[model samples]
Target: MNHAQIRAFHAVASEGSFTKAADVLNVTQPTLSGQVAALEEIYGVKLFERRGRGIEITEIGRRLHAVTLRQFAVELEAEQVLLSARGLMSGQLRVAADAPYHVVPLLATFSRLYPGINFSMSFGNSQQVLQGLFERKSDVVVMPNIHEDRRLHAAPLKREPLIVFVDRNHPWAARRSISITELPHHRIILREKGSVTRKIFETALESAGVKLTDILEIGSREAVREAVASGLGIGVVFESEFGNDTRLHGLTVRDVQLEGLEYVACLKDQKNSPVIRAFFDQIQSSTATNLS
Candidate 1:
C-alpha cells in the first residue's frame, strides 16, 4: 500500500473512530474511509470492527500499526541522514523523561546548543520511560531507578539525597531531623509507581519495617510539592528537585542513604549517532561543572 494509505490505516486504528481519524488527518471522513478500505483490500484482512461510534482495531491492524510507526521513524531518520550527508546539521532527538526537574534543565541546555535539531520529548512515569526505551520509541531516557537489561546501556548522572518535606506550619517544620520510624504516623505523599524516588522510598521503608499510615499517590512532582505544602502529607523527594517556596519546609536530607539514586541516562545498544554523542558530551560536561 502507498504511504498515504498506510498512514490513514494507522491513524484510524490509533484514533479508533473514522471521524476522529479524519479530523486528525485533516481530510474528509469519506476520503479516510476509502484509504483504509483500500489498504484492507490490499492486505486481504479486515482491519477494524465497528463498536458503537468508535471502532476496535483487529489483531492484524494492531500489528500493522506497530510496524508502520517504526517504519515512519526509520523514514524520518533516513531523511535526516541525507540532509547530514549534504553538510546540513539536522536530526530529530526523541527522549523520554520521568521527572521535570531533571528534564527541564537538560533540555534548556540542549536547545541552546543545537537550535537546528528538532526534539520530541515525552514525560511519563519511570516504568513508561523504560518501556519507551525498550520499544525504540525514544532514543534516550532519563530515569531515577534503572533495571538491568542486556540490550540497554546506562550511565549514572548524579547522586542526590532524599529529604522529608513538610508544610511550613507543620510541627516537623521546626525540627532539624526526624527519625525514619516516626514517618508512619504522618500522612505521606508519594509519586506514582515506576518513579525512582517512590521506589527508593518504598524499598527503604520496607527494609526498615516502617509502613506508612496514610499515603497520597501523585503523578507529578509539582503536584506532590503542592500537596505537601497544603498539609495534605509530607513528601519524600530529592532535595535538588525541591523548589524554593515559602509554604514548604524541609528537614535534613538524611536517614535513608541511597546509592546511585540519581538520574540515569540510558540508550539502546549504545547506538551513538553524532547528535546523540554531542548531547551526551554536553550533559557530561555540565554535570562535571555542577559537581565542581
Candidate 2:
C-alpha cells in the first residue's frame, strides 16, 4: 500500500471515526476517506465495517493495525538512534507525573544540562501516570508509589515523611506534634481516593488502629492546602511539599510514621535510551548525594 493510504487507514483504525482520524492527520475528511477507500479498492478487501457515524475494524483491519503499531514503534526507535549517532542536542521528551513537586525540579535540572531538549509534561494521579507509561504515551514518569512491574526500571529519588497541616488559627496550631489516635476526633481534609499521599496516610492510620471518621476530600493538593488554611480541616501532605505557607501550621504525628518514596521510571526496554539514560543518571547522582 502507498504511504498516504496506509497512514489514513492506520489513523482511522486507531481513532474509530473518520472525522477524528482526519483531525489527527491534519487532513480534510474527504481526502482521508478517499485515501482509505483507494487502499481498500486496490487490495479488493474490506478493512472496516461502517456503522452510522463510527466504524469497527474488521479481522483484517485488526491484523493490519497490530502490524502498524509495531512498525511505528520501531520507526521511532530508528529515528532516535540516528539522532544519537549525529550527536544531535535537540529532541522532545514527554513526561508524565503524579505531582509537579517531584517532576518540575528534575526537569529544570535536565533542561539546563541539555538546553536544546524540549519537554512536555502532563500531570495526573499515580494510576494515570502508570497508565501513560504502559501505553507508551510518555517517555518517563515521576511517581510516588510503584508496583512490582518487571517491565519497568525504577530509580529512587527521595523518601519524604507525611505530616499534618492546619489553619494558623486552629486549636492544633500551637502543637509541634500530635498522636495518631487524636486524628479521628478532628475534621481531616485529604486528597481524593487515587492519591499516593492519601493512600500512604490511610495505610499508616490503619496500622495504628486509628480510623479516619470526619473527613473532607479535595481533588488537588493546592485546594487541600487552601482549605486547611481557611480553617476547614486539617490536611495531610509530605513534609517537604508543605513548604512555607504562612497561613498554615505543619505538625508532626509522633505516634505514626509514614514515608512516601519518589521514583523516576521508564520502561525496562527503554532504560538504555540515550535521553532517558541521561535524565535517569542525574536523578541517581542527585539522590545519592542528598542521602550521603
| Candidate topping TM-score | 2
User: lDDT tens string, model 1, 147-244?
Assistant: 67655666657667778889999998888788888988888999988777888888888887889878999988889988988889899877777778
Record all residue pairs in model 1 with backbone atoms less than 3 Å apart, i.e. clashing. none
Considering summed lDDT, which 10 consecutive residues are worst modelled in model 1? 262-271
lDDT of 2 by residue, 1-292 (tens): 5988998997787667898778777899999999998999999989999888778899999999888767666765886688778664987789999878879999998999888888899998888789778666889999886877876999888878889999999988899999999988999998888899889999998898888789999999899999998889999998778999899999888887688888889876577567887788788768976444
Model 2 misplacement above 4 A: 1-81
Superpose all Cα atoms of candidate 1 onto the true structure and report the RMSD in Å to 1 decimal: 6.3
TM-score against truth, every candidate: 0.66, 0.73
Backbone atom clashes (below 3 Å) for every candidate:
0, 0
